[model samples]
Target: MQALLHKIIEQPELHAYWLNTLSMMENVGAKKIKKCEHPIFVNEVILKHASEEARHAFYLKKQIQKIRKDACPTYEWQYLLAPKSSYAYLNQLDIDVCRYLKSKHELKHERLKYAAYLLVTYAIEVRADELYPIYQDVLRAYKSPVSVRNIIAEEQNHLEEMEKQLKAFSSEWEEMCRVVREIESKLHSVWIENLHQELGLS
Candidate 1:
């Protein structure tokens, strides 16, 4: 994994696609949050998080210009690395978490949807915390023009914010975290392996 990260950061094609992948994930996150918005009113925090994720998608896309303009003009599979695993990572987490909530908590309708949001976003935030810093470290090491330092700081705050919300949502929030991490862990492993295969590092 470390070898893959080191190699991925140093190469322009790999770096561009990786950033596009990240941007796609961020776009998915924002869209999912918006889909769950209350019909009448939405929480300000939720709105802010969704907006920030959309910004992250845009920010990452814009950074591709630092490499080569229009290197990834769209999120087409041709321009993305491991698009299958990349899209599945979040989609599967959301599906599995919603299933768990419905089965375990009997949550339905808006409750189930919001709970899924909390857990799914929490899991993704945990992932971002680990991913962005390592990518930033590599970028710094290679003197790369692309930097995720700002994203790193925001992701840290997001993790902290998620913890507070999750605890308030359930006394069993830790167990929920355990389940989410387990699901996301498998998806992430598959995603990384796919990236390795895509990069010919496997």
Candidate 2:
């Protein structure tokens, strides 16, 4: 699975799709953060994270554009013919989760909502930390782009910030983390399946 994921990231066309999809997800995250009602300090931290996410998206989009410009028309067309990218699937999953939470009125309680968001954010940041190194190594191997390294650094910071926020929730931290980990694990499975089907590796 790791090898296949690495292979996907190593391909210019597919990697572009990943980057574009991630950009969309980051934009979604920022929008969600903007809607949350939290303490000033918490909101500020989240806002800073959101801004960094937006910047990451911009960097990724630029990298995608560069990849497209240098890629052959045929290669690009193959990606167009492929199924929805893994990131797209994950993005929709996030949207669905948020919608469900909102519909259930879980988001009506500021503290609960904030805790939920923190858990989700922590899960995502941890996943990013895990995946970014693989992406950085592959990109380095291909001498693809230097921006990814910077993005990885920012991702690490995001992870640290998330950990701090989670720690602040002292009492509920463990339970929330457990729930979020389970949710993320299921999503991760779906992501891998999506990647396999999209790549015709299934």
Candidate 3:
């Protein structure tokens, strides 16, 4: 797992800006899960997520290194620094959903839940996963190096994993949303407290 960072560090094709973006995304993913109302389940999900993200960071770092071996990598701790990057979509999706919900008098509980999942999956996860070969696809059209295409293909497995989890749990999407809202509304402060504690943000 630790070696994954080395792999990311070695990839020359990734830009410094993008590497920093990935670092922020790792934090966002972990923080989003920390906001979950289910503590035991959320904890497990976050732990696994953090590990996977750390590995991804490593991979991305290597990608950055491959591009600029001598360049000193910037390590900013802020998560939302790059607004146009893939992580930006996550923030945008949240705002859009909140805005939509505010306009609705009463969302069907099922729709709300499915919407939330779709918002996260499509807006966040899928968007991030989609960025890969689009970079190469343009290059290929212009006849750029095809080497980066392999990395994009490999990166897709994460999207697959997210889809598998979604498929497994989507049947209960309505119930999950109803329960999530109920749980959230009833214990909103608890979720906030958990986030504060998990992120060590005073």
TM agreement with the true structure for every prediction: 0.97, 0.77, 0.48
In model 2, the runs with Cα more than 4 Å from the true position are 38-42, 70-108
Query: lDDT values of the candidates?
Result: 0.90, 0.67, 0.46
Alpha carbon lDDT at 89, candidate 3: 40
Which candidate do you rate higher for lDDT, 1 or 2?
1
Candidates 1 and 3 compared: the better one by TM-score is 1
lDDT of 3: 0.46
Tens digits of per-residue lDDT for model 3 on 4-39?
Answer: 222333343333544656555655654554443243
Q: By lDDT, who's the top model here?
A: 1
Query: Looking at candidate 3, what is the lDDT of residue 146?
Result: 27
Per-residue lDDT tens digits for candidate 2, residues 1-202, read: 5666567666777777666665666666666666664655465787788788788767766777777774322223243323344435445545554555566435546765676567677878888888778877766767776347887888898888888888887665666576667777787777777767777788
Q: Give the poorly placed runs of model 3, Cα more than 4 Å off.
A: 1-14, 42-50, 70-72, 75-88, 98-118, 136-155, 167-202
Q: What is the descending TM-score order? A: 1, 2, 3
Stretch of 10 with least lDDT, candidate 1 = 1-10
